[model samples]
Target: MNILHLSAVNNWGGGENQIELLCREFKEHYPEVKNQILCKKGKLFHKRLEKTNLKFLTASLAFQMDPRYIRRIISICKKENIDLIHIHDSTALSLAIIADNLADLPPMVFSKKTSFPIRNRKQSLYKYNHPKLKKIFCVSKKTRNVTSEGIQDENKLVTLYHGIDPELQRNLKPGLDLRNFLKIPSERKIIGNIANHIEAKDLQTLVKTANQLINRENRKDFHFVQIGGFEKPRTSSLLQEVKQFGLEEHFSFLGFRENAAALIPQFDISIITSESEGLPQFIYESFFHKIPVISTGVGGISEIITHKINGLLAQAHDHKKLCENILILAENEELIPKFAEISHQMVLQNFTSEIMMEKTLIEYKKILHERL
Candidate 1:
């Protein structure tokens, strides 16, 4: 079962991480099922792939529908005799659909990793509902539900949650002493967030939440640490807001740490202020580290985090409610361990990379069998 994974994005994030995880899983457990990746040249995903033993190819994507990039896809499919093409992002899907139209290509399986509603445009509708896409693996039920609206064949939409490798988490050691590096007092509880500086991440609300905690609530013992890529405009905007709110002392933005997950253990709590998500990888990593979480109940977050059971959840953009949840975890120390333990158990039982890959293999086989 030779599979070619496609990633058209230029940056590294949860979706990219899932591709790496899926490929690694196949390499270790199902060696017979070979996998290769074809990603945008000179990008973060391409760089990360270089560190791995997995087979991969790169193409120069100057534009969305670059002919050269499309030719590379067709050539690779023919040369590699790829049994299937697993598209990782919407851009890749668009490219794949074009390549399929020009030449005979293998069946495609797309991973819908975000809950963003599909655009109602004719092109968008045609690309998603293209008959070549045999399966659409949604990262969460909410993603699947949202995707169903744009897709014609509902059977293709499958809810397949992405997960972390617990073994890797268990063995992961902190690459840096965050408290020492950030010069945070030992007495101060660290509130950590791992997300890129993007509009969907709602980093503005994160700043507002931090302001409420430090200035409004007058809580000086809590420090907020954000770790992710420093996307322009958003990063500058967030910095200005942090400075404007006089939160420089309370907030630390450690832009794009490669070892971000390793720092989870140092966090007293984990937070996600995203207005939209398929489900961030930070939540699963936090579960493995036994770190309590406070997040917005957007996308598929509620599927894993039952409010007040395993974690606290607030509505999107509601900084006051987010602050209240944070205070709840901080003041009630007993609830901290309680929530962490429950979440830890949840990840072990259902949300591990091994479990995810096993289910994925089943789906892959089913798809292949149907073709036969």
Candidate 2:
């Protein structure tokens, strides 16, 4: 089968990462399954695709809609004789919806990566675009619910969780090299948060949590390390909050690093304070590295973590609860092994890349059979 996968950005965020992983494994598993990527030309991720056999097609379908871009996609589909077109983002969906309407156009599928509001104003887009789609793959139960409610065909909406390579989670080398590289003091008990510095992430909670640790005795034993960048305006506010709370010495922000699994193993615990999320790969990555997690009760997090089991969960935007959980983990070394065991089992049982590929291939074959 020939597949055309579409995405709008070049940034290596969660959705892009998911598409890349799928493309890589699909090519490996089915050598006969030729694949092409449709994305903005000359973006940062283009450089990262050098070694892959997948070909890329650049078109004008800007991240948002452009009528001319829809014409371009339809032309490419006809010229390339693509068997199926899989669009990966909301903007791409609009263009693909139109492109699929032309004569001899290929089957189209869409992956829903985010949860939609119950009364989403974007429902009109879904109503118009979803009918043209052969199937909709949602990243979590929440995503599935939103798509099912938006589209007329409940059968077309399927839940396929995000998967990661088991090997990527292995810490082949100790993180001491990274520690020395960052000049992190060797004696402090490190707690790491690996996410971008965005408003949704509520990073100031981490900074304030560090300050809370400082007021207690044995304060020198604990410290905070984060892996993310702040290009947006709110980063300035987060920086000011950290400074105002007197947490400069205890907190370190190690701007976006790819070697997260290696770095995570060195920390005592991993924390996530997101206001919302789908099933995040970070938790699985931490599980692979055998670290415990402290996260908020959001999205599909409960699907993986049982409170006081695999990881601890806090209420959204509750900085005090976040501080309380961090202190609990810091004081009790015994809980670490139990948490790690449960987490590792969770990854092994449900989130492997192999399982995701198997399920995806089945979906493709099922759709093909129905059309035949």
Candidate 3:
């Protein structure tokens, strides 16, 4: 089975990480099923793919509906004999649909990695409900449920939780020392977050939460460390807010670190302040690292994290509640290990790359078999 994966995004994030993980899994365990990737040229995903052994092609996407990009997709499908096209993002799906119209291409599968509601527009509905797309693999149950509203054929929406590779997690060496890098004292507890400066991440709330903990609550022993890309407008706004709140010393933003998961070991507690998600990879990574988490109960987060069981939960934008949760972990350090152990066991039992890929392969085979 030859599969071509398409990613239209220009930056590196959790969704991009999943594509790499899926392809790596296929290469190591299911070598019989050959996989290749086609991504936007001159972008971060293309650049990152250069370091890996994965077979890939790049096309210049000058605009959303670039005719040149569509032609390139058609040419590759014919040249490579691609059995299926796994579209990784919404833009890629649009490009694929256009290519399909111009030529009879292979069936397509889309991975809905976010829980954002599909826009109620004619074009959006047409692209999402297009008959060429055989399956829509949602990252979490919440994602699947949200997607079902937009999709005409409910059968295509499948909830497939992407997970961490235990072996990879164990092998990853600690890359950054938070204390040394930030010049923070060893006595200060590190609260770490792995997310880009995007609207969905609600980094403003993160800044507010930090302010509550540091300035309002007068907790001088806690520091916030964020690792992700510095997107424009949002990053600038977040920095200003942090400054305005006098959180300069309390907060540190490490822009876009490769293998950022390695730094999780340095965190006393992990956090996700997203207003929306399809279950961030950081959650699974934190679970594997045995780092207790405090996150907003949005998207599929509540599906995995039982409030006060494996982790603490807060409503989106509720910085006050988030501040309280942080204090809970800091005051009672014993709960840290307890939550970590339970979360770690959960990852081992239900969430692993092996399980995720196996299920994916089953779906792939089923689709191919039905086509045959």
What is the per-residue lDDT of model 2 for residues 1-372, given as tens digits with 9 covering 90 to 100? 888888776455667667777877887788687778877767645655654566776765454666666777877777777778888886777667756555556777878776653345575646334545778888888778766665666788789987877764552454455467666678777788888776667787777667766754337667788887555676777778778877777777777665455677778889998877776777878887788999987877877889998889998878778888877887787898999998888888898877887788888888877778
Taking all chains together, the TM-score of candidate 3 against the true structure is 0.98
- Relative to the unseen true structure, what is the C-alpha lDDT of residue 91 in candidate 2, on a scale of 0 to 100? 71
How far residue 368's Cα lies from its native spot in candidate 3, in Å, is 0.8
How many clashing pairs per prediction, in order? 1, 0, 0
User: Measured by TM-score, how close is model 2 to the native structure?
Assistant: 0.89
lDDT of model 1 at residue 192? 94
Tens-digit lDDT track of model 3 for 1-372:
999999888889989988888999999999989999999999999999999999899999989888878998999999989999999999999999989999999998999999998899998999999988999999999999999998899999888999888999889887677899789998789999999888999999999999999999999999999999999988999889989999999899999988899999888889999999999999999999999999999999999999989999999999999999999988888898899999999999888888888889999998999999
lDDT of each: 0.92, 0.74, 0.92
Of models 2 and 3, which has the larger lDDT? 3
Estimate the TM-score of every prediction. 0.99, 0.89, 0.98
Model 1: weakest 10-residue lDDT segment is 166-175
* Model 3 CA deviation exceeding 4 Å by range: none
